[model samples]
Target: MAGPGWAPPRLDGFILTERLGSGTYATVYKAYGKKDTREVVAVKCVSKKSLNKASVENLLTEIEILKAIRHPHIVELKDFQWDNDNIYLIMEFCAGGDLSRFIRTRRILPEKVARIFLQQLASALQFLNGRNISHLDLKPQNILLSSLEKPHLKLAEALFGQPPFASKSFTELEEKIRSNRVIELPTRPQLSRNCRDLLQRLLERDPDKRISFKDFFGHPFVDLEHMPSGRSLEQATALVVEAVKKDQEGNFSAALSLYCKALDYFVPALHYEVDARRKEAIKAKVGQYVSRAEELKALVNSSNRALLQQGTCARDLLKEMARDKPRLIAALEVASMAMAKEEEGQDDGDALDLYQQSLGELLLLLAAEPTGRRRELLHAEIQTLMGRAEYLKEQIKMKETRWEAESMDKDGLSESVRSSCTLQ
Candidate 1:
């Protein structure tokens, strides 16, 4: 009997193999795009009738935002559709499951392994923050692994919490947040200092003082070894195409400029590329671009070469930037996160200590300032740090008292249990 539509629902070009997951609002499916490419894709289907106006608006806004963003660690939205009663989001497929499952299976990963995940998250965060978008949902469940052997993250399913596809007033959530409540993670003593520091910053409750993307990428927790550090293949290919077009038009100098930039982008592709054949292919492209640039440069007049050199060779500017230290930014980043932890009633004296250390560094920088105006600016920052430090002292005391009480309660429970066992 064909009672409740036993056959799978067809979405024209896509063949939905199996239901991947179902939540309050939307259900995801593993699909193959039956277009010219026959590409593997994930399709998120959400019934429009089930979503309220706010949810619909949020979904549209998110889709627009996702369209603008492109990074290896972030999930890609290939296509979208408004087909009849449901909205479908075509996205990249990662079969290795999400980080929550990985965590559940292995408990906590080793710091070495965990570093890769953190770096990927940081990279995704950096990308989002650059576009004035906060992930607001950066948990294990949101981070999907591609494969364990080559664990590239594809941060996904960033809907607003477990769904009834309903949008409720954030009155209760806001009140708790306003009351200096914490967003907590289990304290792992064995975690490395960098890992702990990064985790603390990421979970900082005060949005104003929370970690910034620029600072996060610089934190010691970022081990960029396994990280994908390249422009997308599409970008490099586009640049190459433009370079060739310019060369065809007999614009030697312009062609040389683009070829050089294309070659520049290709270097990182080779550096971070995992697949051997892909790496070699990129290397071949690099060679071709380099040869083209060299030939065009030779054809270019001396005046043209001299004029275009600084403008096109961004690598020169990059080298200069590498030498400059962001000391003030670094100091502020540390102090800000520490102060955030203290204000949120979280960080047990440790944040207080870090704030003091960071404060000291700022004071040192202020003392070294050569100009009066700059010195005044530095002094103002120091004053703000001092204000936070004073507040943190009271919070630290409260935290200590709380910790002691908790310790006593645990000890009392253990002693009572022992006595009961003895009597038995």
Candidate 2:
């Protein structure tokens, strides 16, 4: 992380042997831990430069969520470390890639096979929701296949595909494939139609309305309480806290799982303080990088609308760009090129088009209407945008209305009352 306040060199303790994958803000590395066993683990390395305050807070929230969840379907966090510039999260290495890759390679899996995985996933969800934690991002990439091999043996010879063995009966082929592959097929459990329906409810998108333990696990699909575990919840929390404390002391990215452990033990106020301090530290550090950008002015102008929409932390980052206001203004000048003709009062087709596009960006920022000290400045910007959008709307009659209220006027006519883009 090349920020101004604090930028640390990457850690040298772990030997990075292979690239695992890249994520939105971090890269995954397959590395060997420096401990006695020299165990291989996947490290998720996030640069302080990439993490905004919101992202930092989200990371902590995720840690707290994971700390309380004890399920076979979920991946486990092993450790965390922070260097001068980067934070490294040591986690369970799932040799089998995420569910998305598996689904992509195999296309539609057999209903029975999919059901088994779904059952496991539902069990995990059931456990989390029991504790009022929701997995906001629930997609195939986050849903990992078991590191443990499945037990099912191959039942029959390949039908459309060529045989692995040149000479073997279908029955003998089944026996050979079963012996060769560690996996074995299990007898598919018969699920009632209602149970299948219940599974869909558990996977609902709306976090608030999603099914809970009371829904699917009024009678659970599986017995989570009786599931095997190497350590009790208390023991796990202790280990996690120890790891977190070590990472915090070493100035490494503290393990999210450990934060969750600490949260489990501490009061809510304490947890909030710990999280807030981390976020503040991240913001101060990131502001330094933003300040040093060569295109600081242009970057600020271009990012203004987005910053307004995202609010608080983004606004804070933008405030730091004042150090290089000249550069930022230069960048904004480049950004305004497309609107140059419109600004000059030209009403040509190109000018109209530019005006409309610029108005959309401006209106989007206004629509968010963020608060704090920047509220008045943001309001002025939004009003300027709305004035432009209103002009374009008159010129083009851009047939725009949505179920959600347009602007903040609520008492006016809605779609049911009239049909000609009426404001309410």
TM-scores, in order shown?
0.49, 0.38
Error of 1 at 280 (Å): 17
Model 2 misplacement above 4 A: 1-12, 67-70, 148-192, 199-213, 219-424
lDDT of each: 0.59, 0.45
Q: Provide the lDDT at 29 for model 2.
A: 75
- lDDT computed for candidate 1: 0.59
lDDT of 1 by residue, 181-300 (tens): 564434543654566676668657677788776677787557443243544456667888998999999887677666655554454344356666776676566656665665664566
Each candidate's root-mean-square deviation in Å?
Answer: 19.7, 27.9
lDDT (10s digit) by residue, model 2, range 75-173: 777667887777787776666566655555554443323333444555567767767777777656666544323311010111111222434578876
Angstrom error of the Cα, residue 92, model 1: value is 1.1
How many clashes show up per model? Answer: 0, 17
